[model samples]
Target: ATATATFTPTATATATATAMATATATPTPTISPTTLTVAPASGTYGGTVNLSATLTSSGSPVSG
Candidate 1:
């Protein structure tokens, strides 16, 4: 007596993926205004004057 063998083949599967992405942009920073004052913008020889300055960022004072 002889026996016969049978073979079965399986099919392969393929998948596709899609993705969407978005980015937000940041606004540019504005420069802070600085004011400097010196008593007696001009001085004579051997004269002394006071000096002061103010700095601000986003309406807040900056000090060091």
Candidate 2:
């Protein structure tokens, strides 16, 4: 039946896509390419400078 045939291909494509995505996702997480930011790029050397740094990957904070 045409209905059954259409359903079969759609199911196949979905399964294939899901399988490929799962296979790629679990083994390899793309968390590289990070950004590092430090507050107050310049400060007086002798004075007390409260410096802090934040590291992020893909706009998400990287856990310390």
Candidate 3:
């Protein structure tokens, strides 16, 4: 008479995962300053009288 049997084994566990990244914001562009003025505020001429000046940007009036 001979009979003996015993066995026990159980162990398994694993978990790991993560991610984070964020960045978005860009806006910066401004330029203003362009003028040209000329009138008959003070002038003294004889024989020829013809003067004119006009140049603007934010007002519309500029052509290359």
Candidate 4:
């Protein structure tokens, strides 16, 4: 009498996964207050007067 044996093979499995990423945002710049000055403290409507205003942004003057 003759006997036969069966052989079996095993397989290996691999998987890849990815996740979403986020970025940090930058802070906003701050604005400085405006300064206004007038010459001759008081003036009449008929009289001429001079008015001046200083505008600054981030501690620097803004260009037109």
Candidate 5:
């Protein structure tokens, strides 16, 4: 008498994943109680005087 045999094959699978990110912006604070100065504190009649001002915001200089 005689006998027979058979064979089989198999397969595998793979997968991958990714992550995302986000960003946000911050705001600046405002300045208060500004100051001004003059070259001559007081002037006589028909006299010329010079004046100027100092501006600041949150302790930082502001763009013109």
Candidate 6:
């Protein structure tokens, strides 16, 4: 009489991954207070004058 037995099994695994980046700060812009007016204040003596300009911010009238 004779008897024999054999069994084999092996397994190994490893993994790693990482990434990170953060840094932000940007905010600064505010300055509004302007007013300008220019029109036909006066013009005489053989001349032709035509001028007009008016711009405001707090008064509510600023267009381009």
| lDDT leader | 6
Model 1: per-residue Cα lDDT over 6-53, one tens digit each:
999999999999999999999998876765433445666799865665
lDDT, residue 6, candidate 6: 84
Following a full C-alpha superposition, what root-mean-square deviation does model 2 have from the true structure?
A: 18.1
Per-residue lDDT tens digits for candidate 3, residues 1-64, read: 8999888888898988898999998988888778876666445665556787788878877776
Task: Give the winner by lDDT: 2 or 3.
Answer: 3
List ranges where model 1 is wrong by over 4 Å: 39-64
TM-score of model 3 (CA atoms) = 0.31
Evaluation by lDDT, superior candidate among 3 and 6: 6
Clashing residue pairs found in predicted model 3: none
Using all chains and alpha carbons, the TM-scores for the candidates as numbered come to 0.43, 0.43, 0.31, 0.37, 0.38, 0.32
Error of 4 at 25 (Å): 3.1
Query: What's the C-alpha lDDT at position 57 in model 6?
Result: 85
Instruction: Report the C-alpha lDDT of model 6 over 16-38, residue by residue, as the tens digit.
Output: 87889899989988878989877
Clash number for each model = 0, 0, 0, 0, 0, 0
Stretches of candidate 3 above 4 Å error?
A: 1-15, 37-51, 56-61
lDDT of 4 by residue, 23-55 (tens): 999999885775443344567989987676656
lDDT of 5 at 63: 53
Off by over 4 Å in 6: 1-9, 23-37, 42-53, 56-64
lDDT of 5 by residue, 1-64 (tens): 6877776767777878888989887988774654343344566778975565556555655557
Q: Give each model's whole-structure lDDT.
A: 0.72, 0.72, 0.77, 0.71, 0.62, 0.83
